[model samples]
Target: MSDKKDPSVWQGFKAFLMRGNVVDLAVAVVVGAAFTNIVNAVVKGMISPVIGAIGTKNLDHYDSCLSATCQGDQGIQIMWGSVLGATLQFLITAAVVYFLMVLPMAKFLARQEARKKAREGTEAAVELTELEVLKEIRDELVARRRSEYGER
Candidate 1:
């Protein structure tokens, strides 16, 4: 009975895509993807070399074969070294992101929030002072009016 037409599905989809959180999540995904390479490079270049100095050059090579012979996964073989390498890589990535990005961002946000609260407090004080001044002026005007009228 209404003249208005219902919105199209594509319009709704477009609205969802254009939302702030969706855009932020997309940006985060892209930045995370780009940052992954840097973490990987650090692990491969710096951490790997340090580990290599103490042990084998390649961490992947430090595995144990459950079977008598490890012929290309033909027998049961536990690749604990690969697991260790992966774990190390994850730890390095987490540490780099935590120290470089997360910690700094958290500190910055806290400082910003503190500044915002301080500003709000000052604004409230100023507003209260202005209200008090206005009330005093109103009281003075009323008193002068009453005195002049009482004389008549």
Candidate 2:
């Protein structure tokens, strides 16, 4: 029998979980879910009141009646308030995500890349300096060797 052994499914699954993208996505999902509550609260407790000043206090209360009498199927009522509430929620969520998580992370990554590039440039400069020093030492050695041989 061959001594080689194939990787188990568990090992493969573990590797998948360890990948950067997978871990980042998992973390984003958890944070996003948690952030959802804050967005909802902001829209409900803050924005809704401002909107209420202009219109109805609650979006659920804003509806249109299709029939002459809107009493339990006597007339058809189009509940547009719920749609407005959903739209408001969506906007709040998008704004919070962009400002808090995405923007800061992008700026941080840009800073890290800049630092890495600067370090690489410094390393290159040091290598060039080392090369110049070595060349100068080699030239001095050749000069000494030639002078001694000429005297002999």
C-alpha TM-scores of all predictions: 0.77, 0.69
Tens-digit lDDT track of model 2 for 1-152? 23333456667888999999999999989988888888888888998899899997799988999888998767899999999999989987888778987899999999999999999999999999999999999999999999999999
Residue 135's lDDT within candidate 1 is 100
Report residue 40 deviation for candidate 1 (angstroms).
Answer: 1.4
RMSD to native, candidate 2:
4.5
Model 2: residue 113 alpha-carbon error in angstroms = 2.6
Model 1, global lDDT: 0.89
With a 3 Å backbone cut-off (N, CA, C), the pairs that clash in candidate 2 are none
